[model samples]
Structures are given as C-alpha cells and as structure tokens.
Target: MEIWPAIDLRHGKPVRLRQGDYNQKTVFGDDPVEFAKRWQAAGAKRLHLVDLDAAKGDDPTANREAVARIVAETGLPCQMGGGVRDEAAIESLLGLGLNRLVVGSAALKQPDWFASMCDAYPKQLAAGIDARDGMVATDGWLETSSTPAIELAQDLRGRTENIAAIIYTDIARDGMMSGPNFEGLAQMAAATDIPLVASGGVTTYDDVRKLVQMQMPAAIVGRSIYDGVMQLEEVIEIAGDK
Candidate 1:
C-alpha cells in the first residue's frame, strides 16, 4: 500500500478541519511548502494536498500557486483536491506541475465528466468519495447524498480509468483522530475494482501500519499527522517494511 501523508491547505497554510467543518480548523503548520519538504525529507513517497478554502467555495485557484511552489521545492508527487470543477481548472493545475487532481463535487454533478477527464489525462486524476453514514457527501462534505460509496464506485468504473486512485474519506472520522474507519474501507475496497485509498481519522502510527499491512493501495493521514499523533519517518519505514 502507498502511504500518502496529507497537507490540507487553508488560508495559505496547512490546516485540518474537524469532520470537514470549516469553522473548526486547526493550523498544522505555518508554511505548507516547508511541511511538504519535511515529509519529503522523512522519505515520504507522496503528498495528498487539499484546499479547504476552495472546497468551501471560497476560490477555485486558492493555493494552486502554492501547490506549484511545493512541487518545485520538494520534487515529490503531489495529488490535490477541492475547487477543481472543469477542464480548464484541471489544465491550469496540471500545468502548475500538480501530479494529480482529485475531483468530488464535479463527479457528482456530471458523471460523464469523469470519462472525459480520464481520456484527456489518463492516470492524472483521482476520485474522492467522501461519505457520512454511508451516503456520499459532497460540496466539501457539507452535503450528503442518497448515493452510497460502493454504488458510486461501481458507477465510476471505466469512466474514471484515467484516475490513478480512489480516495475514500469517512467524513465522520475525519480530523477527529479516532482512527480510520477500517471496516468501511475494507468493505468499499471489496465492493469496487477501483484501486482504493483510505482517508480521514488516522490518529497514530499504528493506524498507518494497519492500513499498510492490510495492503489497500494507499492511506491518507491528515489530522493525526498535523496533531503530532503520527510521524512521517515512522510511517514511511513501517509502510516500506510492509
């Protein structure tokens, strides 16, 4: 499994929100590029970046330039999500050296867009399936839908083959540091052929090990990494050993 340490950007800094709440944000670091550098130095293979401000409808281009700065500085794979709605936005970000773009709301709005995106940029896009109580959450996790995660994954097959991965976030556990919802992750992984990646509620190095040893393709650590419950070096070593 690939372990991706997350760097969620908010207000131009690395921050994490409780269960995707914008009002309850905790700043993880002052300089996100420096944070990315720290992880790269610790032997991180990839960085999962997100723009919470853009996810909240603030600005589509928020921190994209910062993304470019981090990519240039660390020279590591950076997969970003939030505020990417159209072909132009994807083009702009890819031009900025973003390794991958993660799409959530846009996928829900235009299911056909996935095929077009994958066709245009194969293996350069990722799908984020954020859910609350089994219902797919959208619009920055503020809205829930009748669509279940597996059903959506089933629907997304082939249309999203251009996707490099699937980031499945359990909104209830996100930023709470309880531990990832492993049961749900396993279930979803079993349900779809999509290469699954876990996200949210990662609270310890133990959590990272469990996910890695389980061989789920990837695990996205957010709040725990920011709050010091998890360390980048330890996770990289553990994942490597597994």
Candidate 2:
C-alpha cells in the first residue's frame, strides 16, 4: 500500500480542519512547499493536497501558487483538490504538473461536467467522495446530499477509463485523530473496481497497518503526522514502503 502525506493549504499556509470545519482549523506551518519537502524526504511517494479556501468558494490564487511551488521544489507527484470545478482550473493545475486532480463537490453537483472532464483527462482525475454517515457531502462538506457514498462509487466505476482512483473520505472521522472508517472503506472497495485511496482518520501506525491488511491501494494521513501522533517515516515503513 502507498502512504500519501497530506498538505492542506489555507491562505498559502499549511493547516488542517477538524471534520472539514473551516472554523475549526489548526495551522501547521507557514510554508507549504517546505512541508512538502519534509514529507518527500521522509519517503513519501506521493502527496495529497487540499485547498480549503477554494473549497469554500473563496479565492484560490494563493493556494494555487503554493501548489506550483511544492511541485516545482519537491519534484514529487502531487494530487490536489478544492475548487477544481471547471476545465480551466483543471488545465491550470495539470499545467503545473500535478499527477492527479481530485474533483469532489463539483462531481456531485454537476455530473455531466464531471463526466466530460473524466473523459477529457484519462487517468489524471480522481473522484473525491467525502461522506457523512455513508451519504455524500458536497460544497466542501458544508452540505450533505442524499446520495449514498457507495452508490456514487459504483456509478463512477462505469467511467473507470477517466478516473484514476476513488478518494473515499469519511467526514465524521476527518481531522479528529480517530481511526479510519474500515467498514465504510470496505463497502466502498466492494462497490467499485477503481483503485481506492482511503482518506480521513488515518492517524497511527495501527491505522496504517489495518489499511495495509485490507490491501488498500493507497491511504492519506494528515493530522497524526502534523500533531506528532505519528511519524511519516514510521508509517511509511508500516505501509511496506521501501
């Protein structure tokens, strides 16, 4: 399994929000590119980035610049999400050399556009499925839709050609330092054939071990590494990374 170190950007700084709540954010550092370099030095094969400000429909220019710096400095493949709602945004990020673009809120709010983008950017797009109690949450987790997360995964499976993976996140456990939603992940894995990248609540070596045991393709870790609850190198070793 691959362990992805998360670098969430808010106002060009590294920060993390509890349960996707913007008001409950904790700033980790002032320089996101340096943070990305630290993770890269620690054996990170890939990085997971989120633009909190953009996700909330605010200006994303700062975070976008931060992302460009991280990519240019680290020379490591990075996948980012947040306000990636249009073709121009996708073009801009891809032009910055992002390995993958994660589409969450826009995917749920506009299926046709999502489909078109998926078809347009094969193997370069990932569906960010953030869920609360198994239902899909959109608009930066500020709104919960009636769609079941598993069902959405299944639906995306039909367009597997365009999608690189399904980034399944349980909103309830996100940034809480809790363990991942194993059952929820299992259901999603069973529901779709696309590669599954487990997200949210992955905070310890044990959490990573369980994910490896489940044979997950990849997993995202954030708060634990930032808060000193877990070490990136240790978790990378636990995930069997060389």
Candidate 3:
C-alpha cells in the first residue's frame, strides 16, 4: 500500500474542509509547494491533491500552474482531483508530468468518455467515487446521486483499460479526524478488481494499520498527517511497499 499525503488547495492555498463543507474551512498554509516538499522530506512517495475551488465549480480555481510546478520540481508522483472535467484538463495536467488524474463526475456521467480517456491515456486516469450514506455524491458533495458508491465502484471495475485506480472518499468523516470507513472500503475492494485509494477520516496510525492489514493497496490521508495525529513514517511503515 502507498500512503498518499494530501494537499487540498483552495484559492491556491492549502486548506482542509470539515465534513466537505467549504464554510467550515481551516487554512493550513500559504504555500502549497512548500508543504509538498515537507511531505516529501518526511518520506512521501505519492501525493494526493484536491482543488476545493474546482470542486465547488467556482470561477476561482486552486489547481494552478504553481501546483503543476510542484509536480515538475519535486518529482513526487502526485494524483489530483476536483475541477478536472474535460480531456483538455487532463491533457494540461498530464503535460505537467502529473502521475495520475482522478475523475469523479465525468466518469459517472459518461462511461464512454472514461473509456475514450483510457484509450488515449492508458494507466493514467483514475476514478474518484465519493459517497455519503452509501450513495454516490457528486458536484463536491452537494448532490447525492441515486447510485450507491459500491455499485458505482463495481461499474468502474469492469473498465479494465483506462482506469489506473479508484479513490474512495467518505463524506461524513472527512476532515473530522474520526477515522476512515474500513467496512465501506473493504466492501468496495471486494466489489472491484480496480486498485482502490481510500480517503477521508484517517485519524491515526492504527487506522492506517487496519487498512494495510486489509490489503487494500493504496490510500489518501490528509487531516491526520496535517494535524499531527499521524506521521508519514508510520504510514509508510505500515503501508509496506507498492
């Protein structure tokens, strides 16, 4: 399993949102690139980035050139989502040497588009399935679609060519430091053959240990690492390798 240190950006600044609520925001830093470096220094091999502005469909975006520069300069394999809607966005990000692109709404709305993306960029596109109460959530957690997350993920599993991984985010516990939904994660892992990246909650090393023990492969941990509730070394140790 790979421990992906998260750097969620809002207006180009590192920010963490409570329960995916923009209003309940906590600004963690002014420089996201510096923050990425710190995570790398602390032994982060992979990074998870979210553009909060993009997630809300706001005009002001956080996934900027500066962030692409972080990838170019740091050379850490980074996966990012939020605001990446079209092939152009994916192209732009890929041009920056990004490791992978996490597409949520697009993948759910148009499976063919995802197929086309995979055909165009094999092993580069990742599907993000964020859920609340088991139902799939889209448009930055403001809208709950009729589809359940497990069902949505199972659909992703069938798409073999294009998808590199599936990032699963639980809405209720995100940024609350409660813990990740291990049961939900295990179910999704069972439902799909696609590599899964667990996200949200993730409050302690034991939480990571649980995921690792389950053999889920990868995960995205944010608040815990940022709030001193967990460490990169601890995550790395338990994550094992690959």
Predicted model with the maximum TM-score: 2
Arranged by lDDT with the best first, the candidates are: 2, 3, 1
- How much is 4 displaced in model 1, in angstroms? 1.0
lDDT of 2: 0.90
Clashing pairs in 2: none
Tens-digit lDDT track for model 1 on 115-219? 688778998888889989888999998899999988888787846666677789999898888898889998998888778889988788788888876787878
My TM-score estimates for the predictions, one after another, are 0.95, 0.97, 0.95
* Regions of candidate 3 where Cα sits further than 4 Å from its true position: 60-62
Using alpha carbons, what is the TM-score of model 1? 0.95
- For candidate 2, the 10 contiguous residues with the lowest summed lDDT are 153-162
lDDT of 2 by residue, 1-242 (tens): 98889999999999999999989989987899888999998899889999888889999676888998999999888999998999999998899889999999888877777878988898899999999999999999999999999888777766446778889999999999889999999989988888999999998788899999999999999999988899999999999976
- Tens digits of per-residue lDDT for model 3 on 1-242? 88889998888889999988999999987889998999888888888888788778985344676678789778988888886789888888778788888898888888777878877899998988999999888888888899998887777667655689889999998999999998899898888888888899988878888888898788888988888878877788878843
If both were scored by lDDT, which would come out higher, candidate 2 or candidate 3?
Answer: 2
